[model samples]
Target chain A: MDLALLARLNEERAARRAAVLVTDLQSNTQRLVLEKDIMADPLSALLSDALRMGKSGVVESDGHKVFLTVQAPVLRIIAIGAVHISQALVPMAKQLGHDVIIVDPREAFASPERFPDVPVHAEWPDVALPRLGADRYTAYLLLTHDPKIDDPALHFALKSDAFYIGALGSRKTHGKRVERLQTIGFDEHAIKRIHAPIGLNIGAISPAEIALSILGEITAKLRLKPDGTKIGN
Target chain B: MLATDDDLLRQAEEWRREGRGVALATVVETWGSAPRPVGSHLVIDAEGTFMGSVSGGCVEGAVVTEALDVIESGAPKLLEFGVADETAWQVGLSCGGRISVYVEKVT
Candidate 1:
């Protein structure tokens, strides 16, 4: 491996970007593939799957063997509302290798002592999320049912490339939320992206159980594309 | 099996830079009862050091043996083992499953 390529790979890691180093065994030639540049690679069609799955492996291409060394950014979760559910979720997300941040304007709830292991932001989601760089690797969970808090964040979550957007609300509450979003000019498709009644249908009744369901749903949305769409055809 | 290093590629790179010959074995495919998921890796260095796992305890020894050969010969090899088969039982992978791993030098 060349020093230049090694440096480039490190650069991607530092920037928290997903990429692959494609090495052809027959020629001993290697190419660095940042996730953004996947479409331009000759093997782009075959390579994106590995990128999506966040795994590196040898691939057969036109009778030549290619080794794809995958590098994926760390997963992150931004949970709005330092409520009881978040108490359970913060640690659970951490256990699953997620860097979790709990954001709330309530000083009483968003205290360092309460969540010593995770980062606590005593700011509104709209204010906190932008500083966090909303991207494909980010998942936003609106645990607070307050419209003033969750609504502004929804504006940004819908507009950004955040992979998963989930909010806690009942069907009736979501209906009202949908009406509000429509009044604010978002189309039906954009409004539909919010996974209201957040979490999977796991019949969860407690804070911890609901947190588990939400995390499971978030993981599913991240790995399998939202709306159950397949990538690269 | 899969060891502590979550990022196997970086570990392999470090090993190579340390003057250790390294080979990476990745589970490209798996079927029924396979402990590790597809794309799991086990990187073995020339000095008989390894990190991460391809098949828990079921197939690491065989993959490590092949990985060392891949490091020496600079050749890539594809391996398949079925846990249900009698031959596979002696080697490992007796959990009644099958997996295909691709071993290659990390150049």
Candidate 2:
């Protein structure tokens, strides 16, 4: 409740950066742990574990107990096309508490009738994506097969901190897409972030099934550790 | 809007700023039929003013009772409510679950 702590917490929230506040039970002392500063914190192990898992809890450490509350921004998904896959994906993402926005310049596909109660931007990805402020917490999906729609957004997304970037295409199509991105000066490292052939290899034939796998993949990436150094479940 | 962790923290902080002694009880761990997930918080003030819920209509009165003492004595309490425990029936967690809550005085 100190003015300094309150202001710092507000600043982090406003900037959409993640933070955690830990209150020591016995001493009644408290400290704020920003995601960026986690490595340097004394409770770095506990703090980073909580942040990575996106859950907070109390712990007994060195005979002292403290409660840590993580304050991460809501995960966001920016789908670049209002196509059939998006119709299934948007509602699923919303149900999982992700903020979803569909961006497509084509009005016919981006109509309210197709995506009822969902936020649709009938604007090009180049225009809509900038306004969305896609950050590290945001995931991007390029659904349109059109180079004009998906490629421009790729240029924006690859340069930014979007956590996940996926494009819908077959393996051969993705190879060609990779070639195009390479010609545009995208390196192998940057382009590798895109999960082309879009969803997980769950043999999904229907749009809804594909949507399920894509969300499953996203959640796996979001929740699980690649090196399997997962902390608290 | 659904109350988030930050929202409850802010409410507890604001209450402390307003010269009210506040106790924060957070569900630290749970097992079996624990309705509330870990990290869920309930903020209680000196007069028993509160925001958020640590349990879904179960065992909150006991938590609030302990919170009042936390506010008075400036000490924190680690409380465990469970169907296996003696106070579970009195606490009303009849769903056969164990929940560990940590209550602390937040100055």
Candidate 3:
């Protein structure tokens, strides 16, 4: 471990960014592993493969021992509505370690007084979605209940790499939404990516409970195992 | 694993100041169905006391033995284990996956 590399690793650790030290045992050399933005590190990439194969290990590093800790990256939730569900989901998602953003054109709903301490963007989806680059770690929820707002956001989301995209509506509304998406040239596979009537069926009645179900489903999808995997019930 | 980097360095330095020998074990590589991933670590003292794990419980015995040898010889050894690997199964890692472990005495 050279002083310069050690200093860099210390800086990353202080920032609480996930990092791994890869060391060559034969040569007694080490290198730090860090991603450009939010891609999986070598440890996570290896672990993801291991989790698929049900394997784990304690690989050695240049005379020093190294441990692979699975640190889940920060979950970003982009809510394109400032409705009741948004109000409920923001606090709930924050408690679950998600960086939540509520985007809407209504100043009355998207104001700081309404959603204190949470990021609010009073702009159209075309305007707001570009600023928030969707990645594998991000989940998009369109609860605007208006085609003019939700459809554009879904269009933007479909073009990105977001792992989960959900839109709020009844089955009839979603059916119409899907037709509109098809008219816009999204294929069936791309349309399948959207989780309509978003949220798990926990028999939720209120906005808060519904928000819980949505977050629950998001967690389930995020933590889903790679190869026909199921979480411990 | 319980101790942070600063804490581990401090403890190791204190032990060295007290004239105690220390050995550090690290996971170098893993292949095909191991219990822990690469980069797992464990540290041991001259008396064969150990902290942390490389394979949960499957390969600690061999790791400790290697650590003891590293401490004695003041040299490092790369240990490999798997169900396919002959030497590792005796130490109880008979689970069919291979792991490469490096044991070295820390100055």
Global lDDT of each candidate:
0.81, 0.84, 0.72
Q: Predictions ranked by lDDT, top down?
A: 2, 1, 3
Q: Which residue pairs clash within candidate 1?
A: B1-B53, B2-B52, B2-B53, B3-B52
Model 1 alpha-carbon miss at residue B95, Å? 2.9
Winner on DockQ (1 vs 3): 1
Instruction: Evaluate fnat for each of the predicted models and list the values in order.
Output: 0.17, 0.40, 0.20
Q: Assess candidate 2 and give its TM-score to the true structure.
A: 0.81
TM-score for each of the candidates: 0.83, 0.81, 0.60
By DockQ: ranked, best first: 2, 1, 3
| Candidate 3's DockQ | 0.14
lDDT of 2 by residue, A1-233 (tens): 34467557767876889999887766767888889889999889988878767787777777887778787887888888899999988778878878788899999999989988678999998888898886789999999898889999999999998889999988898888899999989998999899988888999999999999899889877866777554454
Best by the TM-score measure? 1
Task: Report residue A226 deviation for candidate 3 (angstroms).
Answer: 6.5
List where candidate 1 sits over 4 angstroms from the true fold. Answer: A1-14, A23-29, A53-60, A65-70, A223-233, B1-5, B17-19, B31-33, B72-76, B82-92
Two-chain DockQ for each candidate model: 0.27, 0.42, 0.14
lDDT (10s digit) by residue, model 3, range B1-107: 35333334334545555777877676667777778655566767888787767886888977888788888887778887877767534764666787887776766
Query: Which of the CAPRI classes, incorrect, acceptable, medium or high, describes model 2?
Result: acceptable
Note the residue pairs that clash in candidate 2: none
Question: Which parts of model 2 are misplaced by more than 4 Å?
Answer: A1-11, A59-63, A111-118, A227-233, B1-23, B31-34, B44-52, B68-76, B83-97, B105-107
Better of 1 and 2 by lDDT: 2
**Candidate 3 residue-wise lDDT, A92-203, digit = tens:** 8877767898999877878888788688999999999997676666789999899999988999999897879999989999999999989979999999999988998898
